[model samples]
Target: MQDHQSGHQRLTLSDVQRPEYLANPYPLYHRLREHDPIYWDEEMHAWVLTRYTDVVAVLRDPRFSSAWGPVETAWMPEELRPQLEPALRAVSRQMLFLDPPDHSRLRGLVARAFTPRMVESLRPRVQRLVDELLDAVQDQGEMEFVADFAYPLPAIVIAEMLGVPPEDRSQFIVWTQDFGRLLDGGHLSFEELLTTLSGIADFLAYFRRQIAQRRTAPRDDLLQALILAEEQGDRLNEEELLGNCVLLLAAGHGTTTHLLGNGLYALLQHPEQLQLLRENPSLAPTAVMELLRYDSPVQLTSRRLTADVEWAGRRFKAGEEVLTVLGAANHDPEQFPDPDRLDLRRTDNRHVAFGHGPHFCLGAPLARLEAEVAFTTILRRLPQLCLATEQIERLPSLVFRGIKALPVTFASVLPATGATAAAED
Candidate 1:
């Protein structure tokens, strides 16, 4: 275990990558927030903001740009820069990486399909999927939570929404895993970069074919809606359409998978909280919110300063990069009372688990719905569920926090005759 305070008074980004920190980063975040709330990380070539106030301020500030084209290639090796062009181009068009008017334009076109009402309409389908997934392992008495339950629910939901063939849903796991690596604060090795780019290439190609098919024969799906979406004669171009579709697919499932894994792990650790939730399933909404605050799936987000500014007692120049530590902000003691404790009933919880301001997560409602359904159904169906092993592995990424796999045991229940029947009722 590395000492939280050793010789140096200030913590660096390398300290964040320590094995212990990766498993549980809140302690490290506490140290960072306490000692250097707005510190410059020499390794990352960016300012790291850990305080809740600072994170919220930066996120809502218009001066900080989300555009990635200028920021992505800044740290790349000169030789590899050319190799990264295609990947960068694809990312530049993504709503996640763009700022208005592009961000506004793209989001306006896609927001209709993800509105609260629209997402709520997905509850029945999500519930059915959750029940079916649990039904598959209900007889096993044990299962890997991530593979058995967490990953598939949202993945299948998003795939079906995009009109992706059911058979093609499995391939997204590989593509998303590869794409997620690129967001891990650029710690990729030479080989890893190539693999990520290849995976992205394949993802785009696959979607290109889908888009072409939608063009020829329209369907009543989100993808086709995007294809036909027009705002005052403005429409998504080929690159924008491809980039956003891939973004939706990856972002849709990846964060939710982590949320479920992290949320369940947190609950299992705090058995009292788990039991509290079990006794009062009505707490599902607040419980999910608390879980998000306790250990956010997307830990960090970056922004580029558009102009020189003095804030948080520091001067930031135009074009300087800033990394807002969302996970840390979510755990800030000032904002969240008993920040580390798992309280299913925590209220007025305005955690940035889905972010804030214009760039807040588009799929938040869908993710929350999926989680609410999954947690409620899992507790109801699987009696006496408990961790099968204390040993657990976390995904190797700083920006995204998640369990690689969670094995658990439960008293097996008889399989349901009809998974959707209860949902319909």
Candidate 2:
């Protein structure tokens, strides 16, 4: 990729998905902050807000909509909706795309299952799962972390949490990668769009079956809880129930999967921090914050104006959109000191990698718990861990960022059984 500069407008639309930008977007983000803080891009046709303060405001402001009306159908434009009504019904039920009474109600119901006690209760399970994943590859002395470990940890946890059968988890991975294109598909062709929608159709059908079984004989899992959840005379309708299950699976799985992959890559790049973390694996929780800030998995999210108005000293009309570059804000020098350096013990980390305000990720505590368990188990079990190869492929999407695979070599050791299980927290 060649660098070009033009009259204080040094960034270009092409830079958004360039290999160099994907590999190290922070430098480009820094350049944007210096040259054009709230610049508009002709490619996306959306205003790009890079400053941390400006980004947070849009995330919190009610005027900026999730614009979920289109999400119901995998974000198919108006022309395509008629042929894709099934998908529209399913995803619209997801809470990530909801607002007001619906978002509040769905969040209130799901919150019960994701509380501190609830998340803590699963720590042992998470630990055991991590150990099991490592045990499978412990003797190999090398493994692809993303495929072997990172991708499965939260996926299995969330699948079981929602009553998805163990045998079904593999299919979940395939479905997730396809359905996730709803948000960020850069210049996707019509054929590619249809392929994604077909996946969404399959996902809705799979969950519908599980949801039906729960209806007949409700289990004591998160999906059943969601089915039975009620709030202040409000209950999730059928569409709401199924759509949210779709939402939870996507939201619950994607972020943490990338966290481990992205976080481990960050650690491998910064040996000092890796050494510090290996020395005190208990520091994994705090370290997760810096990992999120350093290379956020969800790179950027957008909000559309609900009413014509001026914000951040700029004028905007209703229906316009503002894209918040979280990776850039996480690297904002004004908010974080030495923003580019990976500091494992940084205490002032308040990055919005999981987002902020009303739509703040409901599954944050669970993601954190899963990471803590994954890092500690990996560091404790795999000694002398080092990257097998420096070359890694990252998903080339506008909204999501993650490695496709991470090969690493580590000293082999006898598999250690998890300490006598602690009574549930």
Candidate 3:
């Protein structure tokens, strides 16, 4: 372990201690991706995997394990260890943290709900929500792109599908924020992690109560489907059900929020692309895919080696931890030409914004639908939208690339309480 105290290394561990790295890790990632595509982290006892070919390969390879791992002390400073450990353990309990067979089973449980047909069914309702939200912004003259638009939209949609009442939607916001915070991995304290764990515990307790209610009083909702699934012998015990519910809600809210935020931010940054989207509403789908490829919200993913294996001309021992820098890979010049520039019209954009292989995001259909509706509606309705502030703040999260606040000015808005702004900044 080199300089285990500060968690810093010259070029090896530069990202850990550099504040600039948190802002835009691309330059650092480029250095690591091009030079040391695979390097051992002595302090963390892990390998950093950063390259398009290597990342995509490892994600598809069955030898890497998302779940199997022995618990240990945190690789960071002692003070950060207590908080980091519990969050890691709790996250490991989710399906994202599971290996095959179990991963297949857990994923299959909610797979039907997010399929193309099911997600498509929500289109009319999604359009209505989009219209209602845009209607409110129609007269406001200014809108906080995140608060007034992106963040709340996905939560509402997912909550409706999950059988949560309209009034309780705010609670999901709290839980999702806490969930995102723990995974951010940049500025969280041990105490903050414990506090967030309490939030998760509270959410689980509520979910258990909801599950019992659904068991007795079945309704035409996804939660009911999950409950009745057990009666049909597709049993999901309390732990799995609760864990999966949290997983769905968090993923449902998090990624979609990023897709909308990142996509919209890209539009604001590039006016011609925004005009291109406005000129051809039919281009929304491709624009969304390009946005994902250009600046993925979830920047990277982590995996552990289950066996000794050779990859990209490097050998690794069993039980080694590896970090796959997906954001860097999506922008790899080898994969996408002139990767730094945003090409809304870019075809053949098969980037792994939702990941690849068996662990591919189950909620992809829903995410795509949500993003399509959100981005298209905004461009069609508020074509004159522009940034109110030149400076945009980002959440200090390495795993997800998203804006903390995005203030913008629009020409006008429609009358109603449908658009309420809650800019945290």
Judged by lDDT, which candidate is best? 1
Residues 84-133 of candidate 3 have per-residue lDDT tens digits of 55444555667888887878887787888888988888887777777777
Error of 1 at 172 (Å): 0.6
Candidate 2 off by > 4 Å: 1-10, 70-83, 230-234, 417-425
Residue-wise C-alpha lDDT for candidate 2, range 1-425, written one tens digit per residue: 12336665557544868988877777888877787788676667778888999999889989888756654445567776764676766676677777877788778888988899999989888877887888899779999898889988888999888889766778888778876787773676878877877788788888888877877886888888877753223577777777788888877888899989999998888888888998997788899988988899888888888888777667777888788888889999999999988998999999999888898888889998998878876877788899999799888878887899999999894566435144222
lDDT of 1 at 294: 90
lDDT of 1 by residue, 164-267 (tens): 88678789999898878877776778777877877887888898899888778888998988877632245677668878888999999999999999999998
Clashing pairs in 2: 72-88, 73-88, 308-318
Ten residues in sequence with the least summed lDDT for candidate 2: 416-425
Question: For candidate 1, what is the TM-score?
Answer: 0.93
User: Which ranges of candidate 1 are over 4 A from the true structure?
Assistant: 1-5, 8-10, 70-87, 230-233, 414-422
Q: Return the TM-score for each candidate structure.
A: 0.93, 0.93, 0.88
Model 3, position 65: C-alpha lDDT score: 85
Candidate 3 colliding pairs: 137-413, 138-412, 138-413, 138-414, 139-413, 139-414, 297-401
Arrange candidates by TM-score, descending: 1, 2, 3
lDDT of every predicted structure (CA atoms): 0.85, 0.81, 0.76
Model 3 TM-score on a 0 to 1 scale: 0.88
Instruction: Give the worst 10-residue stretch by lDDT in candidate 1.
Output: 1-10
